[model samples]
Target: MEKNNLYPVFLKTAQLEILIVGGGFVAEEKLHFLTKSSPDAQITLVAPLIREGTAEKAKAFQVHLVRASYHAGYLQGKHLVIACTDKPQVNEKIYQDCRLRNILVNVADNPPLCDFYMGGIVTKGHVKIAISTNGKSPTTAKRLRQFFEEILPEDISWMVENLNRFRKTLKGDFESKVHKMNEVTQHLITNKN
Candidate 1:
């Protein structure tokens, strides 16, 4: 069997126990992503000294800020871990520790140690588009995301709501449902209006 790499997924982070092992700018950047991606994500930062805006962002996003250094024990209850300290050795150690326990981990800016890459995302209400370059170029992913964000209309959420309602009313097998949904949604693409 071929190993399927980089399976993209949107996680419900609200109930997850997430840990970040740093308090500097690197940690702040990671925090920005998490807070934006999953606003209610259960995040805990294990850093001795947080930067100025880190606390504000944490507060805005409801992150748990711990004024302490990273420790292996901190990894015990985390569903996902991000190692973002200035020390490469510390990040590598965190990655290894996560590996030993079969946990998903990402060492910031270190692709080799990352189990997953946080790709660019465009979201409008219930609709979301995730873009990835298989960890090659994040800039491209970011550009694509911006383009999508521009093209996708604000009222598109209305269509999404209608389609969801229609989907709930659908009663058929998988293929039949797909056919019906396609038939219903085809006009949105084909119509020049």
Candidate 2:
């Protein structure tokens, strides 16, 4: 049997059910990213106890918090699961359960057990850049994220919105008049300066 390698996947599980199996800082950080990216997602957090600030934030954000120990049954019907507990055994169990259930799972600090890896992401409207080191070095990913943050134009959001509008307007003709559309977009972007 071929072993599955860890890689980054662009998931469109927005507004879907996501289960988080931890309550510490790591779990909170994952939740923060998910909420920021997909605010409408129904998030269910399963943990015996959550850290102080996390509980308040979960309450404020309306995330469902289930106070319970790690169990394989919790993996059922979840679109995705994140194991952020410090306990290696717990993380491994969650990963195994997710694998059995065909659900995507990310185990904090354990790349080997993860089905998908989270990359450093920078988003401006519909434009997004994701940086990953393939779990070799997170520091490299962070540095790349910093570089993108500095280099990405602040007007990216406006550009993205304009491009979206242009695409909608062009519609089915976009395939035949690609160059003309690009030229028009470039003209618009340049004129915005």
List TM-score per model, in order: 0.92, 0.83
What is each predicted model's overall lDDT from 0 to 1?
A: 0.88, 0.80
In candidate 1, the residue pairs with backbone N, CA or C atoms under 3 Å apart (3 or more residues apart, or in different chains) clash, namely none
For model 2, how big is the CA root-mean-square deviation? 4.3
Identify the leading candidate in terms of TM-score: 1
Tens digits of per-residue lDDT, candidate 2, 139-177, equal: 888789888888888888987787677767664565656
Instruction: Tell me the number of clashing residue pairs for each predicted model.
Output: 0, 0
Model 2 scores worst on lDDT over the 10 consecutive residues at 1-10
State residue 41's C-alpha deviation in candidate 2, in Å: 2.5
- lDDT measured at residue 175 in model 1 versus the true structure, 0 to 100: 93
Runs with alpha carbons beyond 4 Å of true place in candidate 2 = 1-9, 171-174, 182-193
Question: What would the TM-score be for candidate 2 when compared with the true structure?
Answer: 0.83
Worst 10 residues of 1 by lDDT: 1-10
